[model samples]
Target: MHTSVSLKALALLVFCCLSTFAGAAGKCERLVATGNPEYPPYLWRDPQSPKHLIGANADLLTLIGEELGVKIEILYTGPWSRAQDEVRTGRVDLLAGAFLTLPRLEYMDYVHPAFFVTPSVVWVNKDKVFPYSGWEDLRERTGGTLVNNSFGQQFDSYAKANLNLEEVPSLTQAFQKLLLGRTDYVLYERYPGVALANTLGMLDSLETLEPPISSEGLYLTLGHNSACNDAWLRGQLAKKMTELTAAGLPETLLQRNLERWKVQQSQVVAPPPTQDDSQ
Candidate 1:
C-alpha cells in the first residue's frame, strides 16, 4: 500500500506539470506586436494596409509564429514612442525589433543572440558632404535623428556627453532638416535610410559617410508585463531566432523587402506622410 500511494503521488505530480505547461502555452496562442512604423526594410506601415506593419521584421515574426504554432500580428499601434508604451503596458506582447538599452530593459526581456546587426551612418546632403572619418569629426557640428532613436548604448552615452544632436519627431523631418542645411548631418541606419530616401524622392540629395558611427544588434523583445511572458515562449523564441540567424534567413528577408518597398513606392505617386501629418 505504501508503494502504491507513492506511485499515485508521482502520477499526480506529472499531471499537474503537464497542465501548467499547457496553460502557459495556451496563453501565447496569439501575440500582438508593434515597432517603429517608419523603419523601412526592417519595419513599416503597409501603405496598402495602414493598420498593419509589413517589413522584414514582420516577416521574421510571422515565421517565428509558424514554427512555434502561435499567431503573431504586427500592428501599427502608433509612432515609435507609443509602440514602446504598448509593449511596456502589456497592451502588446512583442517588439518586432528594438535595440538593447538600459531603460528599455526595464520593461522587456531581450531574446538572446540578436537576429540582425544594423549599421548606423551619418547622412548628409550630397552638396554639403563633410570629411567625417570618426565620431570626433562631429564634435561641434549639429546632427539630427528621430526622437527616441538610439544607435547603441555606447554611442548614445557618447552623443549625450559630447555631441550636439537635434531630436525630431520623424525621419522625414530629420532628413528635411539636413536637406535644408539646418543640421549638418542626420544619423540613421543604412538600408532603412536608403529605402526612405528613395520613397521621399531625396535619394539624389543624400549620401552616407563611411566608417559608420555604430553597428548595433537589433533584437526581438518580450514585454515584462505580457501574459505570455512564460519560460516556454521565451525559450522557443530564442531557439528559433538562433536557428534562423544561423540559417542566414534575415538577410534574404531584408533584400526581398527592400524590393517590395520599392515596388510599393512606385505604385503611389503622392508623397508619404510627414511629421505634421501624423500629428
Candidate 2:
C-alpha cells in the first residue's frame, strides 16, 4: 500500500509538469508595432472611426502577422516623437514602419531589406503650380511639415540648416495651411498625401510637384531590448517580407485599401438637396 501511494504521487507530479510545459508551448505572446495617430496610407486613425486604423502599412503588418501566425496590435501613443520614445524605452516592441537611419539603428534592429518605397513629394495649391523638381527648387518657397517627421537624416539636416520649414502638429493641419494659402508648400510622403487628399475630397485642390524631392524605402523596426529580438525571428520576418514583395503584395494591398476606402466614402450620407424655387 505504501509503495502504491508513492507511485501515485510521482505520477501526479509528472502530469503537472507536462501540463505546465504544454501551457507554455501554447502561449501566443509576441511583440507588436505601434506609432503616431497620423501618417495616412502608411498609418492613420480613421476620421469616421477612430478606433479602426486604415492604411497600407496597417495592411502590410496584418499580412506579416498572418504569415508569422501571431497577433499584431497597434498602440497609439501620440505623435512620432512619443512613439519613438516608447520603442526606445522598450515600452513598445516595434514601430510598424520607419525609414532606416543611423541614429535609429543604435536603438533598434530593422528587418533586413525594405518592403515599400515612398517618395517625398511637394504639394501645392492647384491654382499656383510650383515647379519644384527637387530640394533645390524649393529653396525659395516656405514649406510646412509635421513636427517630428524625418524626411531622411541628410534631408533633415539640410532642412534644419537651409529651408524655411514651419513645423505643424499634424499632417492634416499642414495640408489645411497649404489649402488656406498659409504656407507655400507642404512636403510629405507621396502615398500618404494622396490618400489624405482623396479622403478629404481635396485631391482636385492640390497637386504633387513634378519630380519628388527624395525617395526612401520603409522597414519594420524591432526594439533591441525586446524579448522578440532573436536573430532567427528577424530572419524569418525578413524572408517573409521579401516573399510578399516578390509576390507583388504592396500593390495588391494598396488596391484592397483603396476599395475599402471607396466603400467607407460611399457610406457617408449626403445632405438633402434643397428644392429649387425656379423649378
Best candidate per TM-score, number? 1
Cα lDDT tens digits for candidate 1, 1-279 = 999999999999999999987876756689999999889889998777778999999999999999899999999877777788899999999999999988899999999888889999999999999888999999999999877788889999999999999987778888999999999999999988988888888999999999999999999999999988988899889999999999999999999998888888888846435335353
All candidates' TM-scores?
0.90, 0.78
Off by over 4 Å in 2: 1-28, 46-49, 269-279
Report the CA-based lDDT of candidate 1 relative to the real structure: 0.90
Q: What is candidate 2's TM-score against the reference?
A: 0.78
Model 2: per-residue Cα lDDT over 1-279, one tens digit each: 999999999999999999887554433356667765656556776655554455777788877877777677775656666678778888888888888777888998888678778788889999888666578877867889876677777787788788999987666778889989989999888877786677678899998887877788888888887766666567767888888889898878777776775666578734223222221
Q: What is the lDDT of residue 62 in candidate 1?
A: 99
- Pairs clashing within candidate 1: none
Spell out the clash pairs found in candidate 2: none
